[model samples]
Target: MTASRTTSAPSVDRLAPWGFAAFVEANTHDTAYRPPVVDGPVGPTIVRGGRELVNFASISFLDLERHLPVRRYFAEGALAHGLSTSGSRMTQGICRPHHVLEQTIARHTGKERAISFATGLLANIGFVHAMSSAAHFDAGIEVRNRDTVFVVDRDVHWSIWKGLEGLGYGRNVHAFRHNDVTDLARILGRDRSRKTVVIAESLYSADGTMGPIVEILDACDRHGAISMIDDANGFMVYGPENRPYAREAAAIRERADFVMVSLSKAVGLEGGAIAGPAAAVDAFELLSGTSMFTAAIQPPTAYAAERTIDVLAGTPEIVDDYLAHAARLRRQMHEAGTPTLPTESYMLSVPIGNDAVALQMREWFVEDGYLVPVFSYPAVARNQALLRLFPHAGHTEEQLDGFLRTLATYRQRLGL
Candidate 1:
């Protein structure tokens, strides 16, 4: 009846379709399930499919809602300020709270000054863009014959890479293996005759590994290069007595030259800042194209950051509780013999092998009453996936235990 139809499939539209149909055919299917929803950062959340799950994927390490002071400040201040900063710092946007927050950040991080941005990516990108603009001229002229080489960790964030790619600084960018100080040294030695600028993160977001700040600083000093450390993942998590960066900061005063950090992680707020020597800060403010073009950070977020710092610095109880919970969770994971990365802090990476296993584990755990994010290639190693769980101050011991039990169930069921 259909005339024995044997028609070739329609050739996919190359320009309009953009290969989305092909991609969907390959990656997506009707069987795929969606992640659940949450009421807030706290545990005992309501998922999308009418199920309740304990949330552990939140970056809200400090349960902000429990902090009455932070809530009160935001409530009263956000209303009075009426939300946005309305403009960039260079234009009509500069406000009193912005300056106050910058000062607070500078003092907290032991740097001369800080320039706040909307997000961490922007801060890192903006810093690189700004620094390159300022430093390029110096390299081309004053530095004399010496080339300007940009040294970056292989795993440096996409934003940092983007900044480098956009710059016209020749093909002098060097990539060193992740956290390999020796490789970095070898690269620097090759460029001993030129001026270099190093860019790296303090705490790697994916694996929870810290960069060797002390060694990197030493290398920068030897090579006569300016170093920029994105402390976005470190900041309040590490204090002077416990962490190397804090100790190094105290010793050298202005050792790293440029430091960038985000307020979103441990600070429990939304903003990023560049902290550095007063001169570098000045140079960034004056010459940075990003700073010149983009609107300054909103006043409310700046105020929120200021309040967050005060809360974190003043209340050791919160940090202590968070650390204790994390340690307990770590011990439980170890006992369960789950393949979690060795971590000394709140960020925990539960390695789940390949993408399929990671996705299966995430789905199965959600069904058993827990929420953990599954991250795969392009963010981490190809085929190497993980369930990144962040322990927050708000979750109780019982809740954490529930999460562990659910994880164990999934771990066994999936034969992980």
Candidate 2:
């Protein structure tokens, strides 16, 4: 998801979850079975087209969405309050659900304030815009927007890059190699005079790799640079006192200037947020065009997200067991000679490195009754597409073992 450009269109033979006759035919020549409409709840096994398949494409690693309490809260909230906020938060003003959700987020992340947005993508764009504009009072702590430099990780989400579009800071923007502290240090040390902002994610979504959080912070500190962590996948999953991973989780919130999390990921709901000082959060809400113009998240989902955070904190064992399964799968993949991408998180990606073979491998998984996702072309480097597998906590041992067998068979058949 690095803030890179993708000029080519996505490969759409069966990439989507539902059928699109025109799209499938127009994109590729494959006549394989189209994506079928799923039925009922999303879990270890998905029902579609009168057949059950082992599921491997859901991001709800803890399966909190399927929990009885989560469902009850969501259903009750929706019943009590109808969907839709009716207007943007600025125009219609804030609701109780949104306010409580923001408070929970701010408390969990140790930030003085937090502001929610409709999506993580919107959050990134809005943060970048609000921080990089001279119209705002702080404007890089009195430094001009044109003078402030943006030093980003080579591979950040595209939304961050989109926020920088037409800012007229052509050479001012610098990119260091992904997770390379030396490169980051070199870029930061070169120009000590400029006010720099280093942007990077806590956990990359595409290949499941993690950024060097502590090291990144140290670099920003020495260079007098502001740090922003896109913790879309790491917020409730890593950086907290009760989170499953990252021993220094609590330190992240205290160190980073800005921490953004996705309600859609660990919270098991929709929307995104930025947690930081009260002043910056207030300014962002008022000045961000992306935030001021867009509608807020619905009431029920916000309430569910607020409760889900507590539910997740209370149940760390679920995440612990799931990560154990993911580690086993990663080891098994290595023993079978199918190496996954560099990722400590549950995100497991097996590189196929060729678009045609990736599509063929997906077909094989489908035949074996598993709906595996393949990323190619624009989403990833051309010819560097891979298989993205999501191992859920609810999946049984038998299901995971069978999927491993499928992988071994594919590796041998492909002769890679």
lDDT of 1 by residue, 308-356 (tens): 8877888777776777777778888999887678657567888887887
Provide the lowest-lDDT 10-residue window in model 2.
Answer: 239-248
Q: TM-score of every model?
A: 0.85, 0.86
Which residue pairs does candidate 2 place in steric collision?
2-155, 2-156, 3-156
Per-candidate local distance difference test: 0.73, 0.80
- Model 2 lDDT tens row, 1-416: 68987697777765666667555667662534355777997777888777788988876667775564887887877887668788878777887888998999998888999999988889999888878776635645442465667888878999988987776543668888888999999988786545678999888877778888889999889988989989998877775444344653655777988888888776667899989989989988766667788888788888888888877777776666667878888888888788889776778898899988998888788888997888877778899998988887788888888888888888888898
RMSD to native, candidate 1: 7.0
Q: After superposition, how far is residue 240 of candidate 2 from its true place, in Å?
A: 6.2
